[model samples]
Target: MTRVVVHAGFHKTGTSTVQHALAQNRDALAPHLRIHLREDFDPLTASARSWSVTRSDKHFAAIGRNALRFFRSIGREDTRPVLMSSEDLCGHMPGRNGIAAYDAAPDILRVIADNARHWFGPALDLVIYFSTRAPDPWLRSTWWQNLRSTRLTKDLDPYADDLPRAADLSAVVDAVRAAVTAQVVTAPLEDSAARPEGPLAPLLDLTDVPADVRAALGIPPPVNAQPDLGMAEVLLALNRSGLDDEALSDAKRTIRRLAVKRSNLSPHA
Candidate 1:
């Protein structure tokens, strides 16, 4: 039976970095895993946010259908467990301006389960996986991450400590376990590079990367690791600037070029 492993993201726990790594290593992972990485997990990105925000079931049901279609498009005849990664899956998008969003909305999980069940038959089991970091660092990292990013909210105060703390994730964890009625693994975000399967292995319920395969394929450097502090500070200041949207976009390009040049010139860079 085919199963679904959902990486329902609690953002700022390196979701982008993980997704980047998987995309980069897709060829390497293909023999061991049948992965689906590009589904639109964020509801706000859909064309009908106002309507979706109102009819959550209908909104997520459509997402479930899309996911089913994607699964079939990948030649679903195989019995491989489907691995999916999406920080937006759980839909608890903490606004960039530091606001609390949903702490527990199991109905979204229910929507997916129901739709998937109907499409894939009742025997298809769905499970969830998540990652968390220490609260203080998680809060700070999230603030820095949202500086140049916007979706749920715009114009975060880059210099302020006014960002709200994420709620104890137990609230959502408990909700997910109840919603899915399946095993849920919560992995820590730190020191995961040392793991034999790397950080995402636990999500797939895998223990180790094959030694022979690891030897044969040289793993590339990470794709979307957090930028160094210097670059992050520069990006933050740029985000807080008075420039309009188009000008701000242009300024980001200019700033990135200048930073790269300075880095190359510096002996330590």
Candidate 2:
């Protein structure tokens, strides 16, 4: 039986970094694992201005097809694990006030799992995983990432002044636990920042991949970072500027570049 590992996300977690390493070091990992990044499995899912809850059945069906294809590619080896990752699996993409607020619907996993079983046999080994980060920084980064899509975040106010309710990590875990018969894994990401390899150690442990191989793949550079506090404040202010989407977006990019430059200059940075 082949194990299927799904890295469903709570965004701003080390997801991007983990995904980057998986892609860059695919050759190294192919023997034991084959990772399917979101874009690679395209017709898999879509997020739009209207999807307030979760994805359509069509999306789940696409994923089922991809899983079947991946399962066959491994031939009779069946020992190799098939890995799939898409933060959308968490159903919290445009979270809180963002465009299509995906309230943490645990049921989403059940639906995805049903689709997987249909394609991969009744006894599929699917493990659900999530990572966490400090709330302040996580929320701030999430806000910015969502902002990139003006259609979703147009009217959402800054969470700084009126802090949004804290995410209940325990609740999220419970949801995952209840939604699937598969194993559930969650880890805090504070230690990941200090490690160049991000959170590969824990991920390897989950897939039963060797820990030593982490050093061999080498660390990939970080991707999609959030702005510093000063920059975040500037961004929030800009959000209120009432500029049209075209101009607000242009200004946001300019501000981010400027802020990033200044951030890199300071000794503290």
Candidate 3:
């Protein structure tokens, strides 16, 4: 039976780094395992996100249809192990669209698993992997990310204190387990970051990518890292500023450029 792994994410947990490494080594890994990243599964992810907000049966049904379509496109005849990674597969990050937790995750995962079973046969080995981080750091990083892209005006301390149970990644994983029968696995970002392949290490292990191919695969430096607290404070101020949309965009671009240059020059960076 073919094995299918889905790295559905808990955001701000080094997900971007994993996706980047996969894209970089796609050619090398192709013979051993087929890889599908967020872009490859956009339609399914979009429907998942929409369903997360609306909680409508219509949107929920769309997720299952999209999953079926994706599997059909890939063809069930090919028996190679397949891996699909997308943070949005579970739903939006907690802070977005007034979402407090991955409340819809169990249902969302059930939809995907049911569709995969229907397409790949009931005997297919399906696994769901969630990359998680410690609560304090995850909340801070999530806040900084929102501050950068969304007009979130809250500072780190308040944001951290105000966060709901979503901060507890273990609970989220438990919820997923309760709702689906697929084998569930988790890799803590802290543990994965210490390995040679960085955040991609745990996944490579799970997929059993050939040892030689693993050695040959390029390990990408961290991508989408959160800025330091100092930089985050500046971003918070920008979000609170009275600038209009166009002006705010230009100002944020300038600030981000400066932050990136500073990060590049830092010895620790």
Candidate 4:
């Protein structure tokens, strides 16, 4: 029986850093655990059959199929914990931003469960980890992250009070829990780094990652980690700079609207 750990992300949740660390330490980490860290977890990338999809629209469609294929590709003897990370999968459904109206939200949830069942098989023990912080901070981080990725805007004001209206985040957690044998791990970005032994331990323990391997990685016990602010800012600037005038202008408008709304409706305000 092969164990697969799916790190379905809610975005701006340190997924990239985790993926990066895994990729950097792939060779070292492999001796203890079988880790799949790649664009699509493709065993082969040199061939043209793996025609890369870089555009977001094409990439997402390709990703949906590729994700399932990646899961099914694993064989019985591969006992090492196989890990895959894709933050987009958390909210990549059809209709609403990350959700499509599947008759209703429950149906949408079932859709995710259905996909997981198909990819991982019935016997597979599924664990869903949602790295979360307080709504306010998380929204701030997300706003900045989007800025870096899309070069859309600089107004942090829009996201300053975003946590209160983040109903989708709560919905995602509920939907995932209802959809599969999942556990919701709530974390705060500020305390995540210091409390290295709690929820993070169970996640790592599932892989049977040895002490030596853990030590080699200098992984803390609680692993209460957060995103690097400087790196985040740089990335946001790069992403914002990449946007064309029209897209950038649109992003600015959205940001401004969000800022005003959050401010006016805020309990503190």
In lDDT terms, which candidate is top?
3
Task: Write one digit per residue (lDDT tens) for candidate 4, span 1-269.
Answer: 55666665555555555565565567877876766655765422211122222224444344445545666676646667766555544443122232221113233223344555676676665556565556566656666545533444445564443334342466657765776654444444345445443334444666788877766674322111323424445444544576676776576555544554554422111
Assess the local accuracy of residue 131 in candidate 3 as a C-alpha lDDT between 0 and 100. Answer: 93
Which consecutive 10 residues in model 2 have the weakest lDDT in total? 45-54
Candidate 2's residue-wise lDDT over 1-269, tens digit each? Answer: 76787787767787887877788888888877877887765444343212334346654455555445544444444567778777766554545444233344465666566656666675577788887777666666666765554433333354433334434555667866887777888887887656656765566767777766666876665666754546554666676677887888899767766766765532211
Clashing pairs in 2: 99-152
* Clashes in predicted model 3: 0
Candidates ranked by lDDT: 3, 2, 1, 4
Cα lDDT, model 2, residue 101: 30
Model 2 C-alpha lDDT versus the unseen true structure:
0.63
lDDT of 2 at 130: 82
Better of 1 and 2 by lDDT: 2
Q: Evaluate residue 20 in candidate 2 and report its C-alpha lDDT on the 0 to 100 scale.
A: 77
lDDT of 3: 0.87
Question: In candidate 1, what are the lDDT values of residues 201-230, reduced to their tens digit?
Answer: 465454234667654543333333445647
Candidate 4 Cα deviation (angstroms), residue 202: 5.5
Clashes of 1: 0
Using all chains and alpha carbons, the TM-scores for the candidates as numbered come to 0.75, 0.77, 0.95, 0.61
RMSD of every prediction: 4.8, 4.5, 2.3, 10.0
lDDT by residue (tens digit), candidate 3, 151-243:
899877878777768799999999999999799999999999998899898888888887888888788788888666487778778889998
The better candidate by TM-score, 1 or 3, is: 3
Model 2, C-alpha of 173: deviation from truth (Å): 1.8
